[model samples]
Target: MRSPCASCVSPGVVKVLIEPLSNQLAKGQLDFIAECLHGQESGVMATVFKVSGEIIAKVASRLFLKPDGTVISNIEDELLVQQILVDVQQVLNQGESRVKSYILPSGIAGVFLEVIHPIVPLVVFGAGHDAIPVVNLAKHQGWHVTVVDNRPGYITFERFPNADQIIFSEPQTIQNHLDLNSRTVAIVMTHRYESDLALLRTLLPSSVSYIGILGPKSRTQRLLQDLKSEGFLPKDTQLQRLYAPVGLDIGADSPEAIALSIVAEIQAVLANRSGGMLRARFGSIHGEEITCLMSV
Candidate 1:
């Protein structure tokens, strides 16, 4: 049940084309993809594979494959779909997108894989005036920002107009409201020793990739000491995720400047890069060069 008259002539080499989303995916499929993103699931979106010089077996215009091997497609060729699934797995593992070409009984097939990742989730544990700038910067970068404070009066929409969520809960109950995962980055800036200690006790064992404390080194050490005294000792791996005296060494004094450094550090940690000057790097500012297409 291949797509009717959907074949296209190739120009020998890979020629990527950009088309409207509606042309490649149905409205229902689009909604499903949106749901996956909202749930913070990482997946791959692939265009129809081009067979040899023509896309003869492209029954489905687009395909979405989750990391767990779940596929959403109408393509009838099971073998071809499986091959594309292999490529999808590769893309997911590498966290990169590229074109993969295969040689089949019919001819060569090429598929363009585009990785889709969920929005980074930022949880600001303090809704003080300083947290306002942090939320603003994170939202501008399209990250999902959540502001949590024990004081209902501090967590208000007016202060954090662009925050995705404003939660009011005691530090002890914060875990009940938050679904912290590897995609989450948090900052403990409650400006209260007791509150920071409580939040750290909760976050240390969680799956958050980054946990930044907004105080001096001594304060963070005290928090850890208190947690240890309470019999909740953080492992070495957990301590590695903690960023005390949070933010880059930007000599920031103003709230806005400090916010910039904090946000920048989060970006670097997620990207697995040191927060260093770009001018010092010899390679591309983004990362290593990526090959757009490969035929094998």
Candidate 2:
């Protein structure tokens, strides 16, 4: 039997008033998105119900989102769809809508749907042409980005208006300034060996998860050998963290195509995935790796 308010589940229409404002994805938002993955905040709608028998699942995700969270769908839970809408209404009823985190009522879990939200710190080592489009796409994806470049003219706010921080510095000298948590993806697009080599030596030992070197494979191998010769990888830990010749082999030639490949690689890594396609891969997309990860 179909549920009474079936129209509510019509892939339904959700309307909210709009206001013009600048967008900024904050740190708190990232943490919340991660925390939600662990079932840490009471209950969430984490599955996407594909119905063949009937379209029983309904997804409404605008409720739990705060003004900032709403901007990016940080707390997307189709299970919490109506309830979250109710939560928002409650806050709106009280004239407020921001919470560090909150629990949801058990009865509210009904919808079966997939809600996607992700957070990655885009660490760019150079502000080159390729780096520009990548940063633009990252911003469009609502990522937290920090850009470092040797040229002030390239790293200026005018050049990268949406970047959280744009710094002009010696490439090798700037690694000390990076925050290499498990969520970071550092891209070294600098064509100069001095700059690229310096970055490898500087960042190889950090806790970062992804390091992509934008160059030919032959150059990358030679550079890695050079790094070893210089005692940059005198330890096992340093060897394990290296991902030189960054990006998948998508046969990308254009700057944008290369950026696309790099971003695709980063996304795969973030999801603990490989081979570049979901259907082509084996096993579940999210599993123990999803839960036991350093951060959800």
Candidate 3:
């Protein structure tokens, strides 16, 4: 678990204690917050408190504080919910927890916001000798890893002892073997051109955020061209999401080094960042400022 920010509370003093009321509300369970705290603390301190309320609640039905000191949760407020969504998007884009203040339309100014994201999921499409290092490295980062391969011998428990799931299935049956969501980072390294094509065909249409193909750029292009020839014309947006010739340009020679590069690229994609030297970038390394309006 991530520690609270040093500046969020006073030293040796806990003004707010956060505890999940139910096991269902545990972190990584809920998609978003239900009730958000919005009020003034100690006359000067601005704070926003968020608590999980309902599991099936939509963002519009989620709770929020109005400028007139009203808490709304039961009813849908499209405008207010849209603004709150903007705030949520900013927090997700920043890829970290942060405190930001928002001013209400009524001119009141005591709303602070923060977001806690869930653990990222990594899915490796091949469980070969080379994928062993990748799975181990990703597990070390506390990510949920699912290893899938069509070959029964390769996809064995002994090979991937630390893997959360070792699936033995064809590339076309990926959906039945694993869950693919927006937080999933998928890597295709089966080394079989036919299997790679089939996996890409299935994954490209899904909501997975990152899809990396482990091969040369020309090879990936050829696969795409083949798909196109077969009447599978992926949209430009889907094609853009693909990271062919996966991993960074770090001159990785060994399996472990290659794993490092791939993991780094996935991390950068999750953070909505360019995998570049931070020293060359200006301003905050996190992201730009996210201005939000607190209204109902």
Best by TM-score: 1
Worst 10 residues of 3 by lDDT: 37-46
Q: lDDT of each structure?
A: 0.78, 0.57, 0.66
Residues 1-296 of candidate 3 have per-residue lDDT tens digits of 22222233333543332322345433312223312212111011112333233322232123433323343444243443445556645544444444443344532221234443456678999988899999999999878889999888899989999898888899888898777877788999999999999999899999888999998999999999999999999999998889989999899989999999999999888777789999999976656432222311
Score every model by TM-score: 0.81, 0.58, 0.68
The best-first sequence of candidates by TM-score reads 1, 3, 2
- Candidate 1, pairs of clashing residues: 52-108
Candidate 1: 10-residue stretch with minimal lDDT: 1-10
The candidates, ranked best first by lDDT, are: 1, 3, 2
Clashing residue pairs found in predicted model 2: 47-113, 48-113, 48-114, 213-246
On TM-score, the stronger of 1 and 2 is 1
Where is model 3 more than 4 Å wrong at Cα? 1-3, 8-96, 101-112, 288-296
- Tell me which residue pairs clash in candidate 3: 37-49
Model 2 has an lDDT value of 0.57
Off by over 4 Å in 2: 1-118, 234-237, 278-296
Instruction: Give the higher-lDDT candidate: 2 or 3.
Output: 3
TM-score of 2: 0.58
| lDDT comparing candidate 3 with the true structure | 0.66
